[model samples]
Target: MTDLPSRVSINEEGPREGFQIEPGPIPTADKVALVDALSATGLRHIQVASFVSPKLVPGWADAEAVVAGFAPREGVAYTALWFNGAGLDRALAFRDRLSVTGSISLSASEAFSRRNLNRDREGNLAAMRKQTAAHLAAGVPVRRLGIMAAFGCNFSGEVTPAQVFTAIEDGLSIAAEAGVALTRLSLADTMGWANPVAVERLVGAVRARWPALELTLHLHDTRGMAVANALAALRMGVASFDATVGGLGGCPFAAHKGAPGNIASEELAMLCEEMGIETGIDLDALIEAGHRAERIVGHPLPSALLRGGSLRAMRARMAA
Candidate 1:
């Protein structure tokens, strides 16, 4: 309540997150359309595609095609996710279209590293070191540090603040070795095991250790706690977040099938607007994009705002 940020950044991850796990082969055009629609809704950042192995994530086999198709909005920054050098190369081809910066992505839970990334903690660190070098060699800056499974993991159980600290320390070491000064740090609740208190403790501890790193939260709604966890972080002055439009994504590798994905972008924006925190978003337009996402996927998404509608709009109607 006391330390809310004046402006919140909502990075929409629906196109990449949702498209990855859906059972059907969503058309490439539909994927591009969603990115374009989100861009028009005043979202400054949009994750358009994942450049991972098509064999591993067939949904993005047409990643190149989707990147080629979308109309890049001048003001919106489009980003893509790629785990290794090959994926990074694919993204480099669209460097003109996508924001091609890199991140030091690691997992707090060793078990989750093995499950999600198919590597142990040591292997993940080695990979990050190699990946960081690759990004620099390619002339792409590596500044953001991301820790996955920061709260708890379904495979390994409760994750304490200590485990998160170790992960962050490891990431910082990688960046330092590369001579890169990281400006941002992202703590992700990859498995949806985060609660509000855990968010506070972890965020507080991380900030205490590295006060210069700007913090971001990448939360999932696995247990319906993404919004609450986000609120907890916001109250502590953490502003940036990664969310999927209409709750459209789930981790295919986390073994949490049929689980809800990241927090809904429209819902998060509404919450921020209601709290007098500026999100720089058109909530109604974003809600309509959520509906469009449902139509593209041919199924209902988990966003309650998509169904219930925005109260702000209803108030205007009542006043009329």
Candidate 2:
């Protein structure tokens, strides 16, 4: 067994990434109910929704209502994704309810950025900086920022680590200029392109550069390397992870061409517990949520939770 860290923080992305790729719209009341259930499970952070234009992502059209309906829990942190200044503006209205506000999209690879954000990597970075600046000027407490597809782009093939580092540097510089202290920043392998070696090396390099920044991991399971890659990150002391219930995820545009969803929250949670890392989440509750999500999508989710039972059950079955 690996010598796991004592604490692991799991950020539930079911409401945001989980619902992003479904064929039709999910009712706002359902979304609220899901968030409420997640809060009851004692998750510290739950992604409620994004504030993108309704034309782009119709699923998150009721972002404001979702936030308004949220009843503040003593320990849970509510978060929302934003695209640009306008999204931040929407998030600002619910300042009291929001614990963390973040902005993210594909990096400026012409092909990926064009389809995802309609901008190049540099242009999107500028927009992110501007929006972050505006939020800072308004005295908004923006905590975490995520850079999507930081490792490799589905449309661009392979992205250089230098490009990823440059983007982070740009964001950090912008944060300094805007005077917003970014609590955490993540490098997301949106298409599941990173291998263990690559994750290790890249994490090493990033840590050497910015040791103080909280590093978050957002890896996909497309190539079946999600667990292995996560192990690499954990070995390097990456404690925070982004996961969806039942491994449900898809970029609204990318799914049409076949981009798989994210790693399963239950799988990761089970792994963490087995490794002696505390995620503060009940594995049974998480698996039950995954099952519920599969039913809602009317399809089998890619999560191992749906295919395999708990680790102990699997072991017992083998013995039987």
Candidate 3:
């Protein structure tokens, strides 16, 4: 077994993935405010927005404005998701003004590929290769290739390890053919269908296959096992994770309506601190960000840390 990483990194996706599914339109200014608040929490990486269709995902219609609004910090890395050529074009336009990295995302499940992206598995793969090449050619610093529905798909059910493996291999092969090296890969449990066993098995398999690749798990709390699955992956030496503040994210095309969202960033930070893992996040500040997110979303969020205080805070109160 490889040695476990002493410090785990978290990518904050609350502004992009978390807000994409909101029913009501969040003002562009509010979105920027939320991201700025999160930036103050010492989060090094944040997915600020996606360059998708505004008509389709009205919540993120202000992707460009949001990017323009946020103050770029020297240490923090900001990224935007791009699915196709047009999204890539949009991201490239702001490349000079904003220090933005690009993420090329694709799905592993055939049904999900068709449902979410209106393409089959092969078509999605082709698009991914093309988009990746474009980003590479543009000198956009394509940092991550995100594989959604890696564990299990809501439409197809039980996505096999072989399917996930093939997707990763194909992505790598495509990048290698273009002479571009991919450093990070993200496995997303799009519908929260993964358990601890599945997390361990798949994470271990990927680690074995690509020993040098950095792996990040994007898990949902649909079955309340997101944290448990994270623990399992950590045991397998996978250290990075994608988390949303206030746990406010769900796929619009997912089979389950009102499904639970990504693991809350504050909750995950609290868990890591308790486990002696260094996340480099201020838990109190993260909780405050969650509260701000709740106000922006105009609803009670699904974060444990937001609902109940952190363990440290509780212990201090008890001791006093």
Candidate 4:
């Protein structure tokens, strides 16, 4: 394995991304407690919840409540996902304390876009453009504008790199014209179809276009390539990544069964630590958190750390 930059940023999406996929509804109180515990782990940036329609995602019904209940910790920034103007307005109501922001996703393929966003790619972008203007006028920050399904799609197969670039330009163009400071922009592998080579190429292409914009990688372990793809992204200086605690998330439309949420946070932290990268996270604490999350979800997590020890132990000593 190759070494990484000394300092790195890890975004905890356990509360928002993890429970959002579980079969049973996670209680709002438990969600608040989990976010509180995560804050103590020294991870300042935590995606607490999503402000989506309760009917569609019942698990996130208590988003506003959880945001209100979780007290702010020093050095911690809490985030909520807002779909559009109404969602952004709901998030802004709590903007005084929690860091309320959102992600706008546009699939590379039209069919996938309709399946994921209930609209075509251009329609999604057009709606987000109007919302972007509103957010800017209200002085609310749009933490991350994500281009979802950038890598590939479950229904449409491999998404072209050109299409991904177009979405990035579209998102940036609106953010610029609206005078909105983008906290981050991420490429989400909503379908878990990205390989290491694809990740490297896509990330490199994005860096070439918007080198100054902070980039994040959100991957799924559908084909068991999340870790490898993430490592490749790290090699490209893509530091920030979105990972759940126990590998607990699946796209509502990205196929059924356990696809595993981005690489588990514990596993990512372990890899980063061994590679001399500082994630500012407590490895043991993160593992414990993963265990707690596994219990809440009532399923065995798809985490390498939970299954085995450090990678060094997996390899035998070289013959002398």
Q: Best by TM-score, which number?
A: 1
Q: Which ten residues in a row have the lowest lDDT in candidate 1?
A: 250-259
Candidate 2 residue-wise lDDT, 1-320, digit = tens: 35357888888888888666686577777778777877776678888888889887787788888888867788888888776678778887887898655543336245677777677767776777767767667776566666777778778888777877877776777777766677787889877788989888888888888888888999888877888889888898899998887877864334454455677888888888888889888777677777777777777887866677787666767999
lDDT of 3 by residue, 16-129 (tens): 877788887889889999989989989998889988988777887889999999987768888887666788788777785455565667777888888777888678768777
TM, every model: 0.97, 0.88, 0.93, 0.90
3 versus 4: better TM-score goes to: 3
* RMSD per model, one decimal: 1.3, 3.0, 2.1, 3.7
**Residue 24, model 4: Cα distance from true site in angstroms:** 1.6
lDDT agreement with native, every candidate:
0.92, 0.76, 0.83, 0.78
- Candidate 1 collision pairs: none
| Model 4 residue pairs with clashes | none
**Candidate 2 RMSD computed on C-alpha atoms after optimal superposition onto the true structure:** 3.0
Best of the two (1, 2) by lDDT? 1
| Cα lDDT for residue 171, candidate 3 | 75
Best by lDDT: 1
Model 2 local distance difference test score: 0.76
Q: Candidate 3 regions off by >4 Å?
A: 1-4, 251-257, 316-320
